[model samples]
Target chain A: MENNINDDNAPKTCEYDPNVNQDELIKAQEKQIAEEIKANTAMVGSLDGLSSLEEEYSNDPVYSSKVKTLLPKFSNVRRTRPDGNCFLRGFIFAYLEYCIHHRDELVRFKKYLESSKEELFEIGFPKFTTEDFHDMFMEVVSDLEGSGSIDRVEAVCNDAGTSDYLVVYLRLLISAHLQKNAEFFSFFIEGGRTVEEFCKQEVEPMYRECDHLHIVALTAAVGVGVRVMYLDRGEGDALVSHDFPEDKEPIIHLLYRPGHYDILYKA
Target chain B: MPMFTKLAHKTSTAAKSSGQTAAKTAAAAAAAKGNVTSPAGKHFLDNTRWQKRLQKELMSLLKEPPPGVTVDVDQAHTKLTEWVVHMEGAAGTLYEGEKFQLQFKFSPKYPFDSPEVIFVGENIPIHPHIYSNGHICLSILTEDWSPALSVQAICLSIISMLSSCKEKKRPPDNSYYVKTCSANPKKTKWWYHDDTV
Candidate 1:
């Protein structure tokens, strides 16, 4: 008794024969899907009025009702590519956008970043590789100091290499933080993997999606909190919002729809 | 060469203003010295960060390479992007007394992306996870690649992979895979079946 067996949207598993040969075909299919997405979207998209979200869900009573509740609070949305790095990309875009308007926060963040590279090096991260990414962040920060414009931030965030490098350094910093406090993080690490293994497999690699641990570690590492508004098919009239690190107020707001994340601007 | 060029297009060039104005000249120099990165591939060479990373890796490898591994220095200097690595089977491994050459092709996205590595010489190993076409099914070479891991680390991993092998035979579907696989082994989403080797 499977529901909608022939439905295109049905949950598709790669368990079709568990065939090793089919991997190439799967890769090709994934490439095609990624290319289609690339052609249709931007890495970091421009803002859209909250009404756009409401219109998208107008046909669905539950989602529409839930979206209606959000419209009063969140004024606009900025989308990022649904690439697995969406969480970090959306987080950085929203956070940087906030920092642009608030210069003191930007300076404080820059100061923190200035010391973080040495910290990462001391933690045994290869200086040769890590330095380039650290320098890129510095370049962007100093560039923002000069320009102080949203267009500059948007362009940097949208540039594939620059944006991806920012995510990489953030990932490294998160990995370093989690490893430094492995005693506390060990309890949360799933699959019995040690902190280092988890960091290598999950946190250090590009294109791997972030999890609860990632968000927790990142928020703690950067000392910037994020508020993720969860939107889903759950039985609720309004979206549930949770702030990372629970105690600190979340300055960065994001809309989390299952696996993907996008920026949210409050009115 | 097609393999290198196809992936080269994805390398990072956004931050090339970092004093690598000599990239085109260097690329031309490389082409004259028999490097596979054609002068046509100069844009791939213009990535300063990528070049710096590769040059550093090359210097370190030449200074003190891992056991049983040696980089073709002249070839690497000719083109920092493509390199030839010589390997001798470890003293006690099943592959003892045999030799292999691996080609390491770096894209402009080095460190961020894994280098494309494959056995390039005639003596492609007859190992359960290795194909006749010289593609080795190692996870670290693909999805498991991390910027933290360097070229030396990959060589060490491959060395360890060979040292731990208990048998000498091609993968079960070696022929079928070699026939249908794309020119670039990186294009295949490899499903590592057995880790025990």
Candidate 2:
């Protein structure tokens, strides 16, 4: 008896082309779908909170305008690429949050910083030893404490060299200290005045540029900053290699002449 | 199905023409009776040594994870050559609860060649440095990659990178992502620069 092809009990026939590998094709499709789901889920989960913070900041006209202006300038160099450095990105956001919160004080300090830069040039750069870097740190602290922005200065000091949070404050401090100041460069010369001379004449007056409390707070932060050089290098290189730390110390080789300092440790 | 049939016919024809000895023929005949392993089968079998090593390491990690992190490996729908991992970090800001998909494409060279890793996600955050596609711009993944570097090291570096991000800005050309991204994102290579983050 011949089977009826149209009967429901008849064996199923696949209508697909014999040349195609359906199983392989289906697996490929499934893989693609899985990847799509994974990617979308990751992005949505990470960005939701940041978007809200951005929304609030975007609403403030003055703050938004400044951010817009500064962003373009700061980011012009890396236009085509993405920054993979997450810690640095976080530090920058934190600093921006700081500036936005302290806008009025920032305005005042920016003005003082502009004038101080000129003085920095006239007074000259110091060949700061570890002690000089410390002294510089203390001087900034005293000035910050006097300025009544001691709280801001203290917060900065506490977090110093620990994260990139200090970069913003350091940028502000450097701007205030170095503007129009060509003299600070003099001490960096090979045979220039010792760090002692440079500290006495140049860094000592940093206190005058801002309130004494503010100066002291900033000074203490610098003490931490100077040590970042060590942390940046971390526990030295082993032959087999080791995982590098996230919070790298600043590459502070700038203060010491090329061959002068090799003590290596902070002791 | 067609491909398998074609391979089967070809293997049978070759076996008939070769006129192999009975002992060797019996082994192949048995293999064919069960399943016809492809030409790449030998390499795949040998390649599992490294795969096994990686899997064991991953399993050990899952049992006792690092601070602020969790990881999972999925093998359900991949080419045996590909390994996919999912990561989450609880302690880190901006990245907390964020799941990142890392796909690894191992080359035939195995442990010698570092696997290609890409973050696959749409609507990924743009930082001044991060491109629309999740190609990281760090040195370790490229010129600085050493055999000593492991999957955990790379993940940790990524976590650290996210934690340190200060600007919260995306790549400057984020608006162009839709225009420039390829139909198949995995094929595109990313350009990385800037020592200062």
Candidate 3:
């Protein structure tokens, strides 16, 4: 067989010399730094005025100007931890905060969530663990049923185990959306990888950061419109905002500053 | 609520355990992992979520194991967190008759964190990716691991790895690696450079 011939000549043997030890040491040190960052930062911070952003960017004229321009449209920001789960964590925090004020939206979202477990199971996720995570998410959503307040939302979002479960479920939703619609998404996936592979490598793993594809999939999957305001050093006097589905009215607003995401409240 | 007594299972991959009879080695490895606390200080055997997940996986493995694989029944009762999975190289392949065993140790963070997996036997297969020290250089065991993968999936992958081998040869640096490598394979920073075994 041609395959056997190819394998005979090209024995892909993995080799690791002494120099490779540096990578392990570096990775361990990075983990140490990440732990320190986690210790110093809250998973989700309390809401604060936009002036904090202004002060953070005061030294850089470009960012300072961008922050000043953002003042009219956004009033405050609630920062999330810089760990890779920030986007997912921040998204749910902001959405639940909005749901607190808008009972109708909360009812609609809960209806969608209640039926998601079966769909995830259908998508071949491990039934037992997936169901466990789904149940945890359901419990959190159910918490907001009666007289839900922002303080209560904040408390639930900051609880370590509960909050992480919600993020994992959200990731599954995105993975499911991508796989279910693989025919269309297959065109967008580069590097010769299939939709299934992309989801396994990028979406299913915990602590893997979200990207534009992730944002697009999550918003489209849940039918929740998100508008992210970019405060990057990219040349701009005003902050640039991109809506998730191009033009759907955004229910939740987020601030994106390079590697991190935080919730934004309208003035 | 099942709290196993604390046991030192740090060197779970030691070849010495397998130098003894297979049945006794199984019990030795099982006894070593009686109780290991997770980073959160919760014992993995404390009927925690990880324990439940492991329990579910073990049940499935026992009920409908993959072909050429079976968990040592004696090890099943000793520890929920550690399992000694006996695997035979797939039939009609380069290693048709050879058998091997892998030790799986699950932390509380699994399936999010990969279970520490390594070959544990006197007859560590002579494969390019498997070192003499019983460390296996496989992507799925390390950086490429996803929570979705299970013990069955891993067994299939390792069997597939052996089944496809064109020749029997140890890794180029097998001796040097065995001398310097850590006991835990997960900590060794494996680079899965070759896929065309």
Candidate 4:
């Protein structure tokens, strides 16, 4: 039997006249854009059962060794769509899942969000638009009171309107955190751009990828620690781990590979 | 290659079909109610969220009209997608005394998508950036539109665009472009070459 699974079998590129093939080029570009939109809109898989991490890493020794280390700790990996908001989505799912089990924590989180709405308004978010997003966020969280299951949570996250609302609400929260604690965060900013400018340009915009600063602000805002396990090609037999809110124990575990993020679960 | 060809064909056909539907809807509305029908297609109106958002925005605009701008739906409350904005030219500008009615056509995406805005009434502004066909070449109305932007912001931008005009004259390629341009300006790939206008 031949091992053709990882073979490079793409068709060779053909040379074409730019002037004559202008329409064709545009058609190709449009198709690519359509495909990208389709990919982004596709339903994300939640709480994927990865019974054995060894199967995924069997081809690479470094990754296999790293998996072996994690095998004792975790059993399943929740896969989010590789859309730009993956980190935020993963965080929401993992945090909500935690909330489902911890009722007191859920109540506390809800109360925090309720009180934070006024803070968000004070931070300069328009009340009308902000209220819509805040209402949706409240609705989703409030629905998780008694009958919350992994399946129900997955359904909510997969729905585009609700998911986008949650993501935007998270972004607003992060922005508010940065704005509120400008003195501490100003040092983390690279350029001379003030915290407000940075928040407007980077944090507030939809689909803006979360950086370290965003992660820090989000964790601080929600008061929930996140543990991100880096899975990369970097020379490491050991999987790298970083905890947000440095001293606190992380409730959510995320697997980070370059630009993408997905939730991880302990056995 | 075949897939690409099919996709291109489908898109063009869809555009043509939508255009015909729009024409028919306009005719029907004129005959029945003497009001302008929504420019948004059936697919756009089908989304409940889009419809609700448009209504909310419409209410907000009506409650608090922006300075020098009066906004109202083109049709009755039933048609929420199309809006007619009457803008009084800001003081100290070339168009100070002039009044222009802007036709705003909102898609289902509402805030997510930029509204198709053009001057509809008589006496279109003779600015260098404003085409004779009522299509105003503005960046914020096109590529620079963000979901964060509201109808109020759009009105402000248009006011600013008109305010900054030094001379009242048609664009350089006004005649040729107007003759060859599509009915919908959104379809036209506008190259924003000049910021000075």
Instruction: Return the top candidate by TM-score.
Output: 3
Note the Cα lDDT for every prediction shown: 0.76, 0.35, 0.73, 0.70
lDDT of 3 at A230: 93
RMSD of 2: 29.4
Per residue, candidate 4 scores C-alpha lDDT tens digits across A213-251 of 999999988999999999887776788899998988999
What does candidate 1's lDDT look like per residue over B1-197, in tens digits? 00000111111222331112122112212222322332213322234656777888888899879999999999998988899999999998999999999999987767666889999988998887678888878767776677667888889888888888888877777777787677788876565443455
Best by lDDT: 1
lDDT of 3: 0.73
- Model 1 Cα interface RMS deviation (Å): 13.4
Query: Chain A TM-score of each model, in the order shown?
Result: 0.90, 0.21, 0.89, 0.84
Q: Which residue pairs clash in candidate 3?
A: none
- Candidate 2 lDDT: 0.35
Q: Against the true two-chain complex, what DockQ does each candidate achieve?
A: 0.14, 0.01, 0.10, 0.07
* Tens-digit lDDT track of model 4 for B16-125: 23322222222222222211222212221233665666777777778887778887555626567778889998889999989999888886545545688889889898
Span of 10 residues, lowest total lDDT, candidate 3 chain B: B1-10
Candidate 2 lDDT over B92-178, as tens digits, reads: 466666666666665433332345666665435444545556654454453233323456666676666666665576665554543
Q: Over 4 Å off in model 2, which ranges?
A: A1-267, B1-47, B74-80, B89-92, B121-123, B175-191
Could you give the C-alpha RMSD of every candidate to the true structure, in order shown?
10.2, 29.4, 12.2, 11.4
